[model samples]
Target: MRLTGTLDPVYNLRYVDSVNVSYYNNRLLPGGGRITVSVPVHNNRFSAWVPPLPAGDRLVLRLRYPEMPDSAGRILDVGGVSLMTGDSIVELSIGKGTYNPRLKKFALKADVVTGEQNIARLAYLGAMRLRNNITDTLRKKLYEKTIDSMAYNTAMQKASELRDSIDRDFIIRHPSSLQSLNILETIIGRYLNKQGGWNASGNKRLTEIDNLLQALDRSLRDSEKAQHLITSLDRAREMKLIPFTGIMPDGSVFDVASLEGKVFLIDFWGSWCGWCRKSHPHLKELYEKYKDEGFEIIGIGEEFGTGKEQWDRFRKAIAADGITWPQILNDPARQDVVSDYMVQSFPSKFLIDRNGKVVLRVLGDSEGLLDAKLKELFGK
Candidate 1:
């Protein structure tokens, strides 16, 4: 790929003597490799040849001018195009107007070479904006008050409904587009992860996703992303064993197999996760109330950061939080449990019945729903 841009000569002469332009491909390769390229600006113009990328991959451009100061007057004037990628030539014109040093902003105009590329670019840009808006809105609402669980649940449910509506509109408008397929995949994956397993609504959503996938080009349908979504949907429907055996914080071996003949919950959590910490009291309450009735909880703490210091911190946090359940702290070097369970997020829970089958999967904090499930199972 090639990029061309013109930076105002005035800005170049007064503020920055030179600028560095770089592009980073945001697609993850099969072996966890990344592709990136960089080039220097000459006479206010810059160009570079990017490495070949997969068809649906994204590439982002970044600009760094070390001589220009940022808002604090200590940092560089660093700006770039937002997340954008796919096969296309990107043209950007910067510093066309007066640069405001106080605002630390520059005027930028960007365009793609082809119509098809423009559509793809707009689709991704829209999707990213929607995601950010939803997340930011929910976060603001959640932290605005002393977290009232009822209010939080209501806000989240409304946000989810809005997201679903937006996703459906995308599918309806751009059924054959790769961006639509991506949106469908995201919707289905979130449903599988968040909704209680295998309900009628869940089944209906899966059917809709499958139909949309079928409507896409056969090559697109056979893409890695599509296949992965299909597999995840299939797995969500099946009651498969998610086996885990690890050492507890107190250094005792804890195994899922050992919990046979009892109803249990496998809680995926971590010390650093705010949602996990928020749900601790509810989990402890359930465990205490039902421990005599053959109900148990196995907390698996995932530590992604380095060093035994993290583990030590986790132990202290767990104790301070009054989490008395049987706990397993993950070895950062070996994340087999996380991979086995496809745990993309923290505070995930799986309810296993006495027959050793997973009966429910809850993502995030849904303590009320979990309590209801436990009552139904134990007839409390």
Candidate 2:
């Protein structure tokens, strides 16, 4: 597939070094795939030969503008711009796309390349429009104090359900498409919460999901990505802890078995999660108070991008937060633990008893559930 594009010089072409074209790979398993190929940009124009993508494959074309200044003059990498793929060649124009610095999101304008690309583009844009409209409405209501926090959350849930219906319709209509499989995976994640638990409606959703998968083309149904999705579904129903090993930030191996026979907490968090970092002080207090009482906390740091910068952020967050617990990093080289846990959100935790059984699993702090449970366990 030949991909050629021109960026509007207004985007400050000097900052953009290349364009990164990322596409779906069903074989990578567990987390789906984000295979990226970088094409160098010169004079605001760039071209590259991308491997042919299977039908229904999702594509995201993004600018590699390091530290590009936003409207607010804040320096940061812009969020990726999703693109529709054509069969042979694609030509895009980065027209007067708007950038919201506060949200760190950018939009792009692409020329009508082919019928396939147009259909995909419309579906993508429709979803985005739905999300943006709902978000804008909610923001207006909140700013005007028309609704309280509880009401806001409830409305957000409804908005999510609305979007899920749209995705469901798309998948049912395009079962054989690879994009259908990708959308199915996302819907599955939403059904399975951060703690690997699902609600009463989950059973029905799972059955429907299975039917959808079977309706897919035989080739896609038999693909590795489909198999991974099936495995995840099974795990959601009969959720059990997966014993694994990980590399610590200090280059040491940490085994889950090491914490056996102790009342411990498995915290899945990332430096980018504000709520996770905010809870550090409380966690520090709990650890220091319960360490001698056979209580332990193992942090599974799920860093974003791999490299010195991300590692540094992880370490810096640890130091700044004064966290002293044993931390296991889930980098590219070691994503097994995170993948095994099926962690969908930050600050997901499992409170295990001395018998190595998960007594309580919660996303976020769970409104002091951790503290109350710990108090009961250790009689603090």
lDDT (Cα, tens digit) per residue for candidate 2, span 31-127: 3336678989998899978776555455777777666556523223355656655457777766545576776644455554444544565675678
Worst 10 residues of 1 by lDDT: 24-33
Off by over 4 Å in 2: 4-47, 51-80, 84-108, 115-118, 146-157, 194-202, 288-293, 304-306, 353-359, 372-380
Q: For residues 1-380, could you state the per-residue lDDT of candidate 1 as single tens digits?
A: 45566665654333433444443321232112356676777776777766656555555566555545443222233455543445456665555344558866444434443435445657656675677787677678668865676877887788777777777776666655667665775666566576575443556777877777777777767887678667666666676666678888767788889999999998888878899889988888898899999999888886543447657767887888898778887653444575556566778888999998888888886887798899999999
Candidate number of the best TM-score: 2
Q: Which parts of model 1 have CA positions greater than 4 angstroms off?
A: 1-38, 47-60, 69-80, 84-110, 114-119, 127-166, 169-178, 193-200, 244-255, 302-304, 307-316, 319-345
Top candidate (lDDT): 2
User: Model 1 shows how many backbone clashes?
Assistant: 1
State residue 130's C-alpha deviation in candidate 1, in Å.
7.9
Clashing pairs in 2: 56-178, 56-179
Q: Give each model's whole-structure lDDT.
A: 0.67, 0.72
Candidate 2 lowest-lDDT run of ten: 25-34
Per-candidate TM-scores read 0.68, 0.72
